[model samples]
Every structure is written in structure tokens, then in C-alpha cells.
Target: MDWREQQPYARKQGESFDVKYTGSCYCGAVKFKASSDPVDAKFCHCTGCQSLHGAPMQWAAIFHKKDILFDEDALDNINFYDSENKQNVRHLPCKISCKQCRSPIADEGRNMMLMFPVAFKIDRRNIPHAFKPTCHIFYGQRVADIKDGMPKFEGHKDHSNKIEE
Candidate 1:
């Protein structure tokens, strides 16, 4: 299926952000920018996220879809993978990554983009002051445990903490 079909969020228009952040892939073949601040930042322990990112959890900064911009030349360097398994398709991320170097770029969901703040061109040590992981989502799916003490939510941290049966 076309990747756009996997995007549940309709592309927003006319929104703007004063502050812009830029990022690139490991090989520098892919680059992008985002505007405004994050709606929320969190650690996602969902199996799909962990598998796509090859990490225990993904640190993501949420932004309105319109706020993200990719350069023209780097357009072809990006690709999407549908992370849908058995759950509703609308609920999973359409994982975006760099084709050349294979860096996990963003997790696109309905209405927003969950990006890796580590990709932002900012000082690494300033991460906490810049973006903070407010909660942990899909903690039940985690392969490993982190003692971060952040509120662990079973479904979506903001929407519901109850585990889905």
C-alpha cells in the first residue's frame, strides 16, 4: 500500500513555528527541520517503536505535522515502513527512516510527528532543558526496564493508562 495511506493524520496547513530545529541522517544524505516546540516528549516502549528504532524505547518530541520540513534533495532519501501488526492501523506509527544510512527519523501518527530530539542540531547536554520525557507509553511491551520513574502508561500516557485487552 502507498505510504500516504498509512498516515492517518491529514496534513495540516497554515500553521507556523518561530523556532526551527534541523537534523540529518547518519550519512548526511537526509536532512529535515521542524518548527515550534513539542506538544509533549516521551519514551515509547511499544514493540513496533522499539523494533523500528532498535532501542529499548524511543525518545520522541511531538509536533504538528505542518511544522516538519524536509529539504528537496533529501526527499528521495527517506522512506516509510508501516508498523501495523494486528492492532488498528490508525494507532501505529508509519516509521520514517533514512534510506542510505538507515537512521530512524520520525514516527508519524495521526495529527502529529514523533521525532527523535537527538536528531536535532542542538547541544546533547542541553537535552533535558530543551525536551523532557514526560511519560512512558506501552511499558507492558518493553523488553527491558528503565528505572526512570516517569509515569508509565499502558496505552497512551495522555489518553489512557489502562492496558488494552
Candidate 2:
């Protein structure tokens, strides 16, 4: 069946994830691109994720910051803020958004970025299999239960899972 077909905000026209992909903020005030590096995807249900995305869950894919290309002007229109980590300490800038629209563009760190799939211009039908979300993280904090077959991790993916029998 279709992945995430139940999603509310449908992708914008002309969004496609191919060998290489480009993405932008909701208002197109900022844009960037990444090579087809087979980034892994994750569905996060932590409270931080929920509040940050203003949703119950956040769908994200990992990419090396070096692979992403953006226009200098577009970069100028972006803002940065550090999110408190599990330790409750502010780290490097984590939240990056378009200043014009205040729409989040990505979660950037030293070398990696966790991108929102909706920000990319990819047709649901054309999304690469590798880009498909494989697990639910921080399942313990879910605001609403998701009954998908994917493993539900009680914490991080490498840790234990919460399986209901």
C-alpha cells in the first residue's frame, strides 16, 4: 500500500525524491539539496518532537550536512535555535527555520541534518524504499498510538522495544 498516504498536508507540486533531491521551506524562502546517500528514516514520538513539529509524531530522514546545497540568499533567510537535549542542556543550534515564514527547514548539527520529508518535493509514489521510515522511536511518549507493523522502540532504535502481545 502507500506509505503515509494518511498524512494531512500533501506534498507540494513538483516534489520528487530521485538520485538527488532538493527541498525547501513551506514558503520556499529557503532551499537545499542532498545527494541520494541512502539516508535512514525515523518516526519520532518524543515529547520534544511532538512540541517541535506541532504534531504527535515527526517523520525525518538523516543526511550529511555536506551533501546539502543551498543558496546564499536562502541561507540568509533562515534562523537557528538550539533545542534542549535529553540532558536538558542547550547544545548547538538544532532548529533551523525560514525567518520569513517561521517554518522549520531542518534540524541541523555539526555534520548531519534530520530533515522533514514533507519539506522535500517527493511524490509518495516516487519515494525511495530506503527513505521509508522503518521504526517508531520514543514510543513510550506517544500521544496517540500508531498500529503499524514497524517495531516500536521504547527508547532509541538501538535500545529495547515495547511490543504489545
Candidate 3:
């Protein structure tokens, strides 16, 4: 099946999508904008996510790599972390963050990027429903128990079994 069919937006060449969200690194040295709503959003409880985010879980939103754009200066101030020494630098997916403030920007995959919701310019008092996480992934690796009613997956979203509360 075509992946775009499962996504929220599919842009054609020459077509444009307006930026719907903007975010910056802690020191404002790096910035990014997302042109469309996320394809998926979830709370990640994987050990890698916990270690990198220094938190129990990470609230992440997924978007097609092309739909998000970083500032021109972002390249100069960003750092990339690759767990594997995959020689294909051009298409290698890795975590990227601001070098100045050490703030995580996003986790870039082959065709998608997982952006942290906390890094966006959101109004704490009135957060949009779109940014809310729909499920908890990697629940088997979680360090804490959450009683929230959201579905908890033992691994990848639809690829794993949903653990009962």
C-alpha cells in the first residue's frame, strides 16, 4: 500500500502547505516549522527514548520529513546522534538536537521525523487536541505505571499486543 494514503497530508510538486506549528531550541539557536499536522502521536516508553530525553516517557509526534523544515542556520547549530554507524549518511535516520542548549529537536527516520511536543510553541493552558498523544508505545520497557485510559502497546503501535490495565 502507498504510505501517503495512510498519512494526513500528501503534497505534490509545486504545491505548498502552510506552516501549522513552530518550535525553537532552548537557546533559540535552532528552529523548525511543521507544514502539516502529525501523521501520528504517542507517548514513547522505550529505553532509548528515556535515556535521550532524560525522562520516563517522551511525547512525540510523527511527520513526514519533507513536511517539516528547519531554519537555514539550523545546520550550523544542530547535532546528530546515530546509534548505528550506517555508512549511508544521506538517508541515515538519527536523533538531532541543538548544539548550543543541548535541546532535542527531533528524531529523524528514513522518511519521517518524530518531534517532541514539549519543544513546540504551545499554549500550556489551551493545548490543541492534535498534539495530544493517542497511545503509549513500548509499554513493556516503561519504568512507571500510568493509569490513564490510553491504549498501551508492548511494542510498536499496531504491531504489538495491547496490554490490559
TM-score, cand. 1: 0.77
Better structure of 1 and 3 per lDDT: 3
Ranking by TM-score: 3, 2, 1
- What's the TM-score of every candidate structure? 0.77, 0.79, 0.85
The global C-alpha lDDT for each of the candidates, from Candidate 1 onward, is 0.72, 0.72, 0.81
For candidate 3, write residues 51-146 as lDDT tens digits: 988999999999888778776566678677775773323234777778899998888787798998888898968878888889999999999999
Stretches of candidate 3 off by over 4 Å are 1-17, 86-91
Clashing residue pairs, backbone N/CA/C < 3 A, model 3 = none
- Residue 18 of model 1 has an lDDT of 46
**How would you encode candidate 2's per-residue C-alpha lDDT over 1-165 as one tens digit per residue?**
231121111223564433388778989988777766536898999998898889999998888665565654575676767766533222554677788988877776666778888888888887777679988999989988898889888888878767551
Residue by residue across 16-102, what tens digits does model 1's lDDT show? 434467888878887877766778898888887776777888888888777777665776787767666643233445777788998
Question: lDDT order of candidates, best first?
Answer: 3, 2, 1
Q: Which run of 10 residues does model 1 get worst, by summed lDDT?
A: 3-12
Report the Cα lDDT for residue 96, model 3.
Answer: 79
